[model samples]
Target: MPTYRTTAVDAVHNDEELRLNLDLLEGRRERAAIREAKAKLQMTKYYNARVRGVTFSPGDFVYRSNDASHDVAGGKLGPKWEGPYEVTEALGDGAYRLRSMDGTILPRT
Candidate 1:
């Protein structure tokens, strides 16, 4: 049986034929990259269309996730949210400085 290598050797008769095949392969790769980029943009648009932007201003009360606070001791039954912490500063891109009820600023945002 003629394997892939033998078939390829039979298909390309000369260096010119090999160069033609390489050019076709390069065109195929460029087209594939364009298709991939279009697919990514389509997926991004579909996802962003469904996304709702929630912006928090300074002094707004927000709840922190227990998982964010690294409170692993609570296990299954513990409260999912840790805080009614006050947002002290809006640090752009949904990050904020939080202050506990007692007025101590959290070390991390």
Candidate 2:
């Protein structure tokens, strides 16, 4: 008669098998990390290629979005942009200090 053995009983309980399993797990983790990094690099490259770099210099006129402005009204029918605000200063990395046409410097960037 043949005897049936449970997985726990049939499994190799040797140090060599344990070491091999550990090495395999470590290899899988390393490959996964490399794959993740490559995916991130590819995504970054795609994004950079499609993205338009916009930089405002000091004294340039630009319109601001009305969504966060206090004077916005009329719901969806309202004007989507405000200001032909003057760029007072370029704070770098696309940030700027803006001044309204009335010459008031905006408190926030």
Candidate 3:
């Protein structure tokens, strides 16, 4: 039996009616839970799809993307990528802690 009742009439109903009402509430709750689970699963799938598959390992070389403001010096001809920076640490997911080729750790952007 459910601890909560859906209607005031349920309080005055016979045992059978009360049981049926409780069952209905339980079924509704079960369905709601299932719907929530499915929505979460769909969102997870979408997020995982959008996440990059690339992973960086410590000691790997990579390029930093150029900042837009700095591009004025080279104008449209400026190189879009800077550095063959060395990866100092793998920060998980697609993030990395990077160092210059000279061994200087770059500040976080």
Candidate 4:
């Protein structure tokens, strides 16, 4: 009971093609929306953290690292953290000198 020429095409070609395309596009859109939501949620959580990272300047006193594992000259193998060392001068980034216990100051970098 054929009423149209469908010998070389699908019997319901137009309707089926449109439906398949729509289904595929809808799946893509939903995936994109879900990805956006996840990214936003992650960013919000990251921004909400009360991150505390501060630095000090020259002539400030800071607790010297007391790690006993940093000794090339057996420096850290003694105390956990020694001095509330007076940061005599900052050499630029993170290097500093302590006003020595015997008054012989030198940069400890």
Candidate 5:
């Protein structure tokens, strides 16, 4: 695959521009390094800025991410915030098994 270069993510502010200019001549290996750095910078930006939701632990109640909203109780029956799904297993990094509000064991939605 071709390398992905990111100007925005790898920016050196105007003051640092002169100092960073030499990295341009750093060749393919260093170019690759800068590419990786730019990717990591983008990932870090996403984690630091774009990610806004709060994290909950084992017993905490978290809303399920699915869009089929319905209300199951209070005599209302449409798609409601499915959980307060008790976080069960931490599958890999972002995936988890959630206990449905109705006590059904469903894959993390």
Candidate 6:
């Protein structure tokens, strides 16, 4: 009867192969991260370039849209805009505290 060996003798080569595979994966991860960062920067730049800022000041005459309560007379077919309200105060970020032409404070939307 003859005995056959069934064990690997190249343990060093296996270790080297594993180390190389790990290094390759690490490099791929670094490259992917860099690409993602560049793409985010491009998106930010594009949006900033195209975005327009709107500002409102006190005492500005602006129109107000009719609310749901206004639909009693006109219903869906009624007028959409109702006001030439005056801006009493600039609340920043395009918001304003408004007053009616009669000087009555309107509710904030």
Full-model lDDT for every candidate: 0.88, 0.85, 0.81, 0.69, 0.64, 0.81
Clashing pairs in 1: none
| Model 1 lDDT per residue over 1-109, tens place | 9798866675446778888899899899999999999999999999999999999888899998887877556778878898789999998988999998999998883
Candidate 2 lDDT, tens digit per residue, 1-109?
A: 5545543453556667888899899889999999999999999999999999889888899999877675678687888989899999998877789999999998873
User: Worst ten-residue run, lDDT, model 3?
Assistant: 1-10
Q: What lDDT tens digits, residue by residue, belong to model 6 across residues 1-109?
A: 5334436446898889999999899899999999999999999999999999866688789876777236336777888887888889997766788898998998755
Clashing pairs in 4: 66-80, 66-81, 68-76
RMSD of 2: 3.4
Candidate 3 local lDDT, 1-109, one digit each (tens): 5444554345556788878988899889999999999999999999999987778788889987888225336768878888889998887877889998888988877
> Where does model 4 exceed 4 Å of error?
1-49, 68-78, 107-109
- Model 2 residue 8 CA deviation (Å) reads 9.4
As for lDDT, the candidate ahead, 4 or 6, is 6
Better of 3 and 4 by TM-score: 3
| Candidate 1 regions with alpha-carbon error over 4 angstroms | 1-16
Per-model TM-score on C-alpha atoms = 0.79, 0.75, 0.48, 0.38, 0.38, 0.53
Q: Could you give candidate 5's per-residue lDDT for residues 1-109 as a string of tens digits?
A: 5456544445547547756666655676787999999999999998998767655566656677435443354344455455567776666566666776777777422
Score candidate 3 by lDDT. 0.81
Query: Would you list the rank order by TM-score, best first?
Result: 1, 2, 6, 3, 4, 5
In terms of TM-score, how similar is model 5 to the real structure? 0.38
Q: What's model 1's overall lDDT?
A: 0.88
Which candidate model has the greater TM-score, 1 or 4?
A: 1
Q: How close is candidate 2 to the true structure, as a TM-score?
A: 0.75
Clashing pairs in 3: none
